[model samples]
Target: MQHIGIAKLGKRTKSLVKRLKAGDIAIIDHVDLDRVTAESLIDAGVEVVINASSFISGRYPNIGPLLMASEGIYLIDAVEEDVFNQIKEGDEIVVRGDKIFHKGKVLASGKTLTVPIIKEKMEEAKKNIGAELEKFATNTLYYMQKEKDLLLEGMKVPESSVNFNGRHTLIVVRGHHYKADLKILRSYIKEVRPILIGVDGGADALLQEGYKPDIIVGDMDSVSDEALNSGAELIVHAYKDGSAPGLERLKKMNLPSKLFNALGTSEDIAMILAYEKGADLIVAVGTHANLVEFLDKGRAGMASTFLVRLKIGEKLVDAKGVSKLYQSRAKISHLIILVFAAFTTTITIIMSSTTIRGILRLIILKIRLYWGF
Candidate 1:
């Protein structure tokens, strides 16, 4: 089948997704693409994907390719490494099987990934998990030695302006269907009104849902300037050498922020910060917890995540989907909202039809007669 679309190219998949439009061809150089990137691209409504790197390097069972293929996305893999240079942005391009043709010229070629092919590759990656685990474990041990002081004793977290003391803290990260989880937690949010913390890009996610974050924590690379100035206290994540590059971004924005120097991911430090500040419960949404997720994020080992979870222990809850079981403890305000909703519905029904109004009156009279009123 010959497929055609306008080309939209970027070296970084996440960055490109922001500018992508529906029906455009996405061109990228992501190696062993991660699920989050795939989800973003799918959300952008692109029909075709062209990758200049190995889509699955067999390093781990990454679900990016599988996600794209299952969603009816055409994935062309291992094209020339310089394919980005060949196709200009907004060029009309056509693909037939593995060949790329533009304006009657053969520009480049690669293998078009299908669902079945992705399934087979994932199976092979599974068989190699044992070796990958060994490497991950070794890396963890190595980093733990170098960063133990920071993880255990040297963690200098500042007093957050947002008081999390004895309160429930919700940390939102833009990972793995976070928007779905957040949508499900809306009611819980309204009732409990937990202290909301957005990790980098997750801050933008919170803004999209019409909630202001109490605290924003991360490396400051992906978060927007508007989010930085959203009145949320910012906590900057720093490197092992006590240098925080994210501080520059904050300074340019002319906003005040505090720095927390640590070795692991920003999300890990965020959890630690909440736990240290006496949060009674920590609910994490869109944060990666499994080995596959770590590998997908290019983490050699999840040492900090491991240590932080052990520290938080009984107070932490990971929500697979928050919409089902999470309900806010109902209060008088909830009753008021419910009653208001019922009143609005009653008024609409009464105005819409005369017969419906008569039925309601008859039911009320019957109740009054039965009560001898």
Candidate 2:
């Protein structure tokens, strides 16, 4: 069958998989069969696949050809661009080796379609191994819960701490989708410009993006010294009694911070702090907004987030997937200005250099001699 040429599979494969619907044959440009990403794609039920990458280009064991063969899927390698040029979006074509046997004729020859078959096999594997996965997930959840309890106990201390007044604040949580969400929010840094706060690892994420978080609030396990020293106010999340274990880490780093003895996630405390600080607008990015994401992180209930968001009410905006909703487009004027600046800089550099002038003159003389210019 004719497949759409949506090749160039790399780090963006996951996003593309989420966007694609079933029965759409994706012509993947490259394949790394041994990677977990390959398995994820296979599980996503991509109907047809083409591997435009070299199977044994290096010492790395190529798994694409083997994966296709084991799954009884057609595959081809070292084919030319002519094969892809012939295929359209909705053409019925039989895939076999490099040659596409279509209607008793060789329509196009190219790499094997491995993604669709791998997806089918991955589904079969998941069904057979579903129970084990569930059990593992359950155990992980239990462990996380116990850890959260321990952390909560350590957070309780009878000390002077920061108080929260009902204001709008966003507390970012570290999770699987955190990076993706953070990238989305980075673009809106100037627009939303909320009191940026990070919870532990989330603070590290902010630091990674060169953003000095306004406040760092969390248990302080995963946050780095660099992040703590990033000029943001630090608030250690503690229990209702105001005991905080994270304080020790800060002490070790010779950093001073206020302890906020409270219940719920560090993000919840951050929101409370924002509200208390009279923040009118609270926009949360890379923060958990859905039950699945929360549960995945072993949170039993998002009571704190619920209450905090409730308090913020009208002023709170959850920008979880805002990056996907809009893309920054370069304006014509901006592009023109950039191009003009680039040309001017190039001319200036060329005019300022004797060696470059000689090289250009030699090239121009060669061109003239060749074309009689």
| Best-performing candidate as measured by lDDT | 1
Q: What TM-score, over all chains together, does every model reach?
A: 0.83, 0.47
lDDT of 2: 0.59
Cα lDDT of all candidates, in order? 0.89, 0.59
lDDT of 2 by residue, 121-189 (tens): 445544544454455457545554544532333333323233333434555756434566778676467
User: Please, what's the RMSD in Å of model 1?
Assistant: 7.3
Model 1, 68-160: lDDT tens per residue? 999999989999677877889999999889888899898999998999999999999999899999999999988787767644674678877
Model 1 regions more than 4 Å off: 321-373
